[model samples]
Structures are given as C-alpha cells and as structure tokens.
Target: MRRVESLDVLRGVAILGTFGTNVWIFSSPGGLAAVLGGGGVVESGLRALSNGKFLALLSILFGVGLAIQHSSALRRGARWPGWYLWRSALLLVEGVLHFVLVFEFDVLMFYAVVAVQCAFIVGRSTRVIRGWMIAAGVLHVAVVGLLTAALYGKDVVGDDAADTSRWLDQVAFRLDNALALRAEAVFVLPLGMVLFLAGARLLRAGALEQSVRGDAIRRRLMTWGLGVGVPLNALTAFAGTDWALVDRYLCAPLVAFGLLGAITTLVHRTAEGPLRRGITAVGRSALSCYIAQNVLASVLCYQWGLGVTGGPLWTVTCFLIVSALVTAGAWLWLRRFPRGPVETVWDVLYRAPQRISSRRTRCPQGRSA
Candidate 1:
C-alpha cells in the first residue's frame, strides 16, 4: 500500500512532542515528582504545551494505522486481520522489553495491548464505531473524576537517591518494580483506548487521508482544537496542580487532538521542501526515532553516562538537539533503505510465520505427484 505523507508528518510531529514531554523524566535526578515540584516558567510552558498531547497523538495514530491496514487488506481480498494481529503481538513484545530494560514508564506496551483489542472493531459499521468511541470517552472521564477525588492532596513524589550506578542496575530496578508498572498500565489503559477509538473513527471517515472533504474537516479540527485546547493545557501547566486524573484524562486529550488538527492542516498547506522531507523522514522511521530518544536520554541524563542533571531548559535543549540529529539520520538512512531498522524488523517478524507456512505448503510432503 502507498504511504500517506500526512500520517508520516503527523507521526513525526507526535514523536517530537513526546520527546519534549519525556525529557524531564529522562533527565531529572528527582524523577517525575521533583520535576513537577520545581516549578518555573519554562517547566510550566513545556508541561502546558506537551504533557499528554503527544502521547495522545501517538495512540490515535496507532488506530489510524490499523484502519489503513484493514482497508488495504480488503482491497487485496483478505477477510481477517491476521497480519495486523501478528504486528501487534510483535509490538507488545518490543514494548515489554523497552519497559523492563529502558524505561519503566513506557506507553508502547499499553498501546500494543489496546491495539490488539482495537483490531476486532476495524471493519465495523461507522455508526457502531462512533458509538464505541463516545462510550469510551465517557468512561474515561468518569474514571478520571473518581481517581482525582481519591488522590487529591497527596504527596506522590519519592525521595529516592539518584542512582549513580551501572545501566544494568537501572534495568534491574525496573524489573523489580514490575507490579508498579502493571498498576500504571491499569491506570492509563482506559484513556489510551479512548484515543485509539477516536483515531479509528477519523480514519473510517477518511479525515486523515487526503480528500477534498477532508480538507474542510481538517480546518475545523485545527480551529476548534487549538482555540479550546491551548488554553486548557496552558492553565493546567501554569497551575502545576497535582490533579493527575484531570490533566491526563480530561484536558490533555483535547490539547492533543487540537495539536493534531493544527499540525495536519499546516503540513497540508506547506509546500514540499527539505524541511517537510526531513520531518516526513522522521515520521517514516518513528519507531527507530522513539527508541533512539530513550537511549539518548539514558546516556545523557543518567549517572551511567553523562550523570548530568539540570532544569527544564536543559531538558528542552537536549530534546531539540536530539530531534535534529535523529531527523537528519532518518533522512540519510531512508535514502538507502525502504524502512527504518526497527520497522524492518517489525515487518519481517509479522510476515515470518506466513512465509514459513507458505514454504511448508509448497514443499512435497511424502512423494512427488
């Protein structure tokens, strides 16, 4: 199937924003609580602008990709999503490894888990899918409200000493905290599902795909998304309140969709140039770029590598530099290869079972006919 440049562009932008949101967690010696407590304009700005928005975009894009793949399979006369399920299974494995070895607070595992469930609803009627999306959103909001009421005015930050040890120790620590990781997943899964369903709905309606009608929808998304989303996110950032449920479940998704709309519309309007090419390249190799960001952050912020810790400004600077380098690297690599290294691995894994089965079927079993 042919690639959609808009999706690539949006994915690239999502990757960049994700990096911005995660930089603090990756770089801070105080962990998430410390960063949240150490309030300032720059920190607040980053929180307001990024926070949940990028992750929401990424989740939505995952659903969009599922819809695209299902549509492509229908064109080829396939009746089921066997290949897509294989892809999701592989993604779940990768997400597990990433969480255990690299970052415990990773979202990929949750995304993978939800994506497999999403596969079941891929070709459902538009009305059914829309109803599911609405129901999911409502459930998410209700759950967030309850969580916020329970966890309000609590000191959630820990005072653990900064680990100035080997990377293996860090990995071991994450493994040891497996229960905590699971708890985190339970908390975030509902919200992720809402975004996933929303993305599938949009793709089903052909909003992400280029069309004369899509342009009008995109404009509306951009206008309303930004107009409302920006202020709510900004307020959340500036307040620095510990209303995790409200921010993550409620406000963040709005900002994320708005940013998605605005970015998609802008990409459509912008003429082709090196800038567009570079961003699209980064998007094309989004998996590789995302994993690379985690590696880079570990090296630069952790004691095993640079052992450096600073404020939000430092984190933002590191993110910008890494994004530029990653974009350029992706552009260069794409010139020679069809897909990113991680993407190539994913494709191979997803197809390997089918390939082996085909080979067995082709070979003579007992005797030549």
Candidate 2:
C-alpha cells in the first residue's frame, strides 16, 4: 500500500510523545510504582504537556490504518477482516512479549484486542457504527467517572515496591504483578474502542484530505479540541490525582484532535525540510522505532542496563536523546532499506501464513490436463 506522508508524520509525533510519557516511569526508582504517585514541580509540569494526548492520538491513527486495510481488502475482492484476524493476533503476541520482556506497560496487546473487535464492525451501517461508538464512549466515561470519584473520596494505598535491578528478576516481577501492572491496559480498552471507531469514521469522512472539506473538519476539531480541551486538561493537571482521570482520559483526547488539526495544517502549509523529512522517516518505520526506543531507553535507565535513575528532568532528557537518535537512525535505515528491521520481521510473519494458505489452495501441476 502507498504511504500517506501526513499520517506518517503524525505517527512519528505520537511515537515520541509516548516515549515522553514512558520516560517518567523508566526514570523512577520503582518502575511501576511511580504510576501511583506524583512527581516534582518541573516533572509534573512537563508531564502535563504529554500526559495522555499523544497516546490517544496514536489510538485514532491505528483506527485510520485499520480503515485503510479494510478498504484494501474490499478492493481486492477478498473477505473483510478475513486474514486481518491473523494480523491482530500477531499484534497480541507482540504485545505480550513486549510487556514481559521489555516494557511492563505495553499497549500493543490491548490495541490488538481493539483492532480485532473493530475489524468486524467497521463499514457497517452508519447508525450501527455510531451506536457502538456512543455506547463505548458512554461506558468509558462512566467508568472513568466512578474511578475519579473513588480516588477523590479516598487515597489508593499501594504495596511497597520490590527491587527492579536485575533484568531477569524484573521479568519475574512483571509476571508476579501481572494484574496490577496490566490495570492501565485494561482500563483504557473501552476508550480504545471509542477512539478506534471514531478514527475510522473520521477517515471515511475525509479527515485527512487537504482540500476544503478536510480543512473544515480539522478546523472544528481545533476549535473544540484546542480551544476547549487544552484548557480543561491544564486545569486538571493542577487539580491533583483525583482529577487525573479527567485529564488523561477526557481532556487529553481533546488535545489529541487539536494536535492532529494543527500538525496536518502545518504540514500542508510548510515546505519540505529536514525536520519534516526526519519525522516522516520515523513514521514509516514507526513499529521498529517504538520497540528500539523502549529497549534502548531501558538499557540506558533500567538497573540491568546503565541503571541511570534520576529526577524527571534527567529522564525526560534521556527520552529526548533516545528519540533523536532513533529518528536519525530510522532516516538512515530507510535510505537503504524499504522497511525497518522489526517491521521487516513483522511483515514476514504477517505474510508467511498467507503464503502457506495460498499454496494449499492452488491446483496441482497437472491442472491443464
């Protein structure tokens, strides 16, 4: 399939923003333990810039890709979501491995689940799709609401953190605290469903077009998402832990839409430059870059690697340094190779089963007789 430069650029941005969020956790002395506590003034302030916005944008972009895939399938006279199930299943396996071996808070597994559910439901009647989206949105909101109220009403006491110095022991620790570590993934699934469907709908509605209609769509998103969403999100940042649910789950998504609008607009208006080209390359090799960033960051920060623990600013600096290197590396790799290393492996795995299936369905050599 042909690549969309705009989408690729967006993906690059999302990839880095996600790392921005993850760096805080990686920098903390207690990996997963940091999730339940607040950070220093500078750290918290910087965290607000990323918090939940980019992750939400990433979800929407995933939906857009799913829509594109579904379209490709239909155009080829193939069954909808036929082998797509296999694709998502592969994603789930990747996610599990990532969670256990790399980052404990991997999003791939949950995204895989949402992709499966969405593949079956997309391209249905407008009313049906809207119903699903609305239902999921409402359910997610209610759940977030209840959780927020509970947090405000009472503090959440967490267990003392265990040592996370050894790589092997860290793997064991993730396995032992599976539920606790996986809670964020589970909690975000409903929102994933909502955003995933919304993204498909947006794609169908020409959300990425560069013309008049597309401009209008983006304008509205900016008006609501930036003009309204960003402010509320900022307020929540200062509102303390109780309001974090409001900030990340609710307000952050608003800013995501706004960022999409702003970025798309900027790309269309600006001429090609090093920064744009760099991000585009990163976007093309997004999966590979994402995994590399995490693994490299772990090597730099985790006890098993460089064991570089520090305040939030230092960790954020680490994230920036890693992100820059990955972007530059991807730019260099793509110049010689069509895909990144992991992407190459992923595509091979994705198509291997299909090759076998096609071979099985082929006629024998004597078919002419």
Candidate 3:
C-alpha cells in the first residue's frame, strides 16, 4: 500500500510526544513513581500535556493502518486482511521480546493481541462496526468509573521499583509478574479497539484522504476537539487533587483526540519542506525509532549503564536531544534505504511464506510431484 504522508506525520508527532512522557520514567531512579509524583510545575505541566495523548494518537494510527491494509487487500482481489494475520502475529512476537528484554511496560504486545480481535471486524457493515465502537466506549467509561471510585482518594504511584542492581533478575521478576505488567492493558485494549474502529470508520467515510469533505471534516475535528480537550487536560495537571481520576479517564482522551485533530490540520497546511520530510521519515520508521528510544533509555538511565536520574527538565532535555538525533538518523537512513531495518525485517518475515508458496506453485511438474 502506498504511504499516506498525513498518517506518517501524525505518527511522527505521536512518537516524539510519547518520548515526552516516557523520558521522566526512563530517567528516574524512583521509576514510574517519580514520574507520577509530580516533581514541580514543569513536570506536572508536561504530564498534563502529554501522558495519554500521544498513546491515544499511536493507537488511533494503529487502527488507521489496519483499515488501510484491509482496503489494500480488497483492491488486490485477495482475501480480506490477507497478510495481516501474519503481520499481527509477528508483531506480537516482537512485542513480547521487547517487553521481556527491553521494557516491562511496553504496549506493543497488548496492541498486537488487540489487533487480532480488531481484524474480525475489518469488512463488516458500518452499522455493525459503529455499534461495536459504541459498546467498547461504554465499557471503557464504566471500567474507568469503577477504577476511579475504587481509588478515589488514594495516592496511586508506581507499582514496584525494579531491582536495578541485577538486570536479569529484574527481567525475570517482570516476566513472573506478567499479569501485573499487563494490568493497564485490561482497560487500554478496549479503548484502543474503539479508536481502531473509529479509524476504519474515517477511512470508509473518506475523511482521511484529500477531498472537499475531508477538509470540512478536518475543520470540525480541529474546532470541537480543541474546544473540549484543552480545558480537561489542564485540569489533569493538578497532583494530589481529586481531579486526577477525571483527568485520566475523561480529559486525557479528549486532549488526545484534540491533539490529533490539530496535528492533522497542521500536516495538511504545512508546505513540503525539510522539516516535514524529516518528521515524515521518523513516522515511517516509527517502530524502529520507538524501540531505539527504549534501548537508549535502558543504557542511559538504568543502573547498569549511566544510571542517570533527574527531574523533569533533565528528562525533557534528554528527550529532545535524543529525538533530534533519531529523526536525523531516520532521514539519513531513508536517503540510502527504502525502509527502516525493522520495517524491512517485518516485511521479509510476513512475505517469506507467500514467496515460498508461489515458488512451489511455479516449480516443474516432475519436481513438484
């Protein structure tokens, strides 16, 4: 399938934005606890601005990709979602390795698992998909409501600190307590399905592609999205306040959608230039870049390496610098190669079986027999 620059740009923004939230976690000795504890105005502000927003963007993009793949398969006269099952399976394997070896809090495994379920609805009627989305949204809200009530006045922080002295032990511990690590996924997967369906809906409606209706849709999304999203996100920044739950469940998703609208609008308006090209490149290789960020974080922040721990400013600085380097690397790599290393590997793995099957079909009759 041909690449959509807009999706790529939005993905680039998501990748960088994810780093904004993750940097604090990566750099803190207190791990997740330090990030959630609210260091100061800067930290709180960053958390309020980012946190769930980028993740939402990434999830939405995942849905968009699935929709695009399904459409492409139909166009090629292949079975619906023709290589997607293999792709999702490979992604799950990649996600598992990443979770066990790189970051315990990785979302890829959950995404892959959810994606398998998402595939079932690919060519379903719009009404059916919409119904599913609504159901998922309601469930998400209910779950969040229950969680809010359960932890209403409590201070929720990091689950447990990793034993940084022994890296292998830390991995083993996380592996043993895998369910705990996937606790967030229980709530997240349904919400992601909603976004995935929403993406497919948009594609079906021709909202993402360039057209008159697309322009009008983008405008509405920008206006309504920001109008509702900004204030709610602002409310989420107050630490130790009663509003944290509301901010997380309600405001965060609003802010995320709003950001997506704004990003889409900007990507549409901006002229093609070096800046656009670089960001698009980053988005194109998002998986590679994301994995690289975690790898770099492990080396820089973990006790086995630099063991650097600091406040939000330090983390933010690190994030910006690393992002710049990664973007530059992607741009340079793209100049010489058609795809990122990870993307190439993904394609090769998924396509290998098809290639073998085709070769077998083409073999001489005697040899085939």
Candidates in order: C-alpha RMSD to true structure: 2.0, 1.5, 2.0
Using all chains and alpha carbons, the TM-scores for the candidates as numbered come to: 0.94, 0.96, 0.94
The residue-by-residue lDDT of candidate 1 on 1-369, one tens digit each, is 576668998899899888888888877778776765747786777666777788888988988888788888889887667777777878889989988777777778888888877788767887787777778777877878887778678766666533546888887777777777578677777677778878877766667656788777776776666787677766666654667557656778887777777777777777878988998998999999989888888788888888777876687778877788889999999999999999998888888898998788878863576
Report the lDDT tens digits of candidate 2 across residue range 90-151: 88998999999998889899899999999988979889999999899999999999988777
Candidate ranking under lDDT, highest first, comes to 2, 3, 1
lDDT of 3 by residue, 152-248 (tens): 7777775677776667977997888899888887767778898887777766666566778877776676666678777657856674545665676
Report the number of the highest-TM-score candidate: 2
In candidate 1, how many Å is residue 196 off?
1.5
Best candidate according to lDDT: 2
Which segments of model 2 are wrong by more than 4 Å?
Answer: 364-368
Off by over 4 Å in 1: 161-164, 364-369
RMSD of 1: 2.0
